[model samples]
Target: MKDLDTLKYFLGIEVARSASGLFLCQRKYTLDIISEAGLLGAKPVNVPIEQNHKLGLASSPIFSNPLAYQRLVGRLIYLAVTRPDLAYSVHVLSQFMQEPHDEHLEAALRVVRYLKGTPGQGILLRADSDLTLQGWCDSDWAACPTTRRSLMGWLVFLGHSPISWKTKKQTTISRSSAEAEYRSMVAVTCELKWLKGLLLSLGVRHHKTIKLFCDSQSALHIAKNPVFHERTKHIEVDCHFVRDAIKDGLIFPSYIPTKSQLADIFTKALGQRQFEFLLRKLGISDPHAPT
Candidate 1:
């Protein structure tokens, strides 16, 4: 192992070791964002989005200059790299990039305001936590108002530290929630398989079958079963890939209840209480806490 002084950074996220473990806040970068958006003194918010709020393609008056909205949204997207808590909200606003309105701009500013309050918050990568790889996957059925596309989200952890995650709209629409979730599992399986290979190359050996937790029983059945019918025919390709991975011992997709699904935080909006619960589950610290 290299000396403590020699360790600089990893994956663009700076590192600062301490007696406890490592402190990993991007305060300087976050401040720069706040300054750039002229929101350094803006009122801080408790949450990224208001309770029960719905945002969709605006049918109202357009902004005087759409580029201004685009610029702000662009900055928020960068902020989300270390703030998975804001992923779903940022993504929802991003869909309005083509023609954003005053309301959408205000909603995006609320996220910035939230960031103002929690600028020091970041994932804590404890030194002694087990390095075993574990993951959770989830999806929201027909969550997008315009396209009716399901949102798929997954988070991979090296012990308690989240190393990778994604929140994206499925490429194809699904007829049922089961199919939407199964497609998400397939996506997560493909990612886990690649990560396994990469880890092996780096001499980080792990079990042959990486366990992947999902919140859909039907999806798990489809991956574990070989039967193909009309309901499963449309997603034949994804089904085959996931099943093949299971057969080859590359990934083991298991069932997890919706309440415990960590990936749900990324796939859609939730009530404030549920959102806060999932946020803590993702290992994000409370910025308001005393340092």
Candidate 2:
């Protein structure tokens, strides 16, 4: 690899540098997806998924063209490379790919419409910000109707730039919100440990506690508490790995308010105001000049 003057491309995301900072976007790819979906003339929307909209298998006739549904989903999945904010929405929509119907099509189109309005939106890595590793994990209990499985989500940041994130439905059904949250915390803890190890291998040590923030006080209490009772015995052995690591001084789980939970963007849908607030918090910015 030769030393380049400006970041033209990296990991499939087109990077454009400016005097202020680096702006990353996938505008060309986004436009191609819009055209392929034949939604170029569709009105743009401010938000991706509609607030309070519950999606499920359509009760009406399913889409005859499975390829069309697959194609749109594939585009959206690729769009997620530069758009971590759309992870949850895309993950939810991708579930219906096997048997997509008109409802699913409309939901997917809503996301495309949203992309149309904010095509230039992407992660902004500021040059002056401190590169610290901080993370937040959150979960939504029994969010899936079919399996009643919880969704686990977390966001890891190197300073202001979000480097890692995930939105996955839990494999095991959680009996309570606290249990669901604890499971998510464990997942985040494992990621943090791996990140720390990876950085150390590259001679980049954080030298501080990798803060794993969670919104559930019950989960936090469970982690700090040693005595497990009958109610908590059902939790999987792997989920307790976080608690063990905490004892070994590997990670420190911290408490954070729900409003400030950055990982909330990944677990479920949000209103325009709340969603935009978290988007800004995640270091996503409009490539265009700010109004």
Best by TM-score: 2
* Lowest summed lDDT window (length 10), candidate 1: 6-15
Tens-place lDDT digits, model 1, residues 14-104: 5577665676766666777778879988999878877555677556677788898898888778767777888888888898898888788
TM-score of 1: 0.91
Q: What are the lDDT figures for the candidates, one per model?
A: 0.82, 0.85
RMSD of each: 2.7, 1.9
TM-score of every candidate relative to the true structure:
0.91, 0.93
User: Which lDDT tens digits does candidate 2 get at residues 105-146?
Assistant: 889989999987887788877776565678799999999877
Off by over 4 Å in 1: 1-13, 286-288
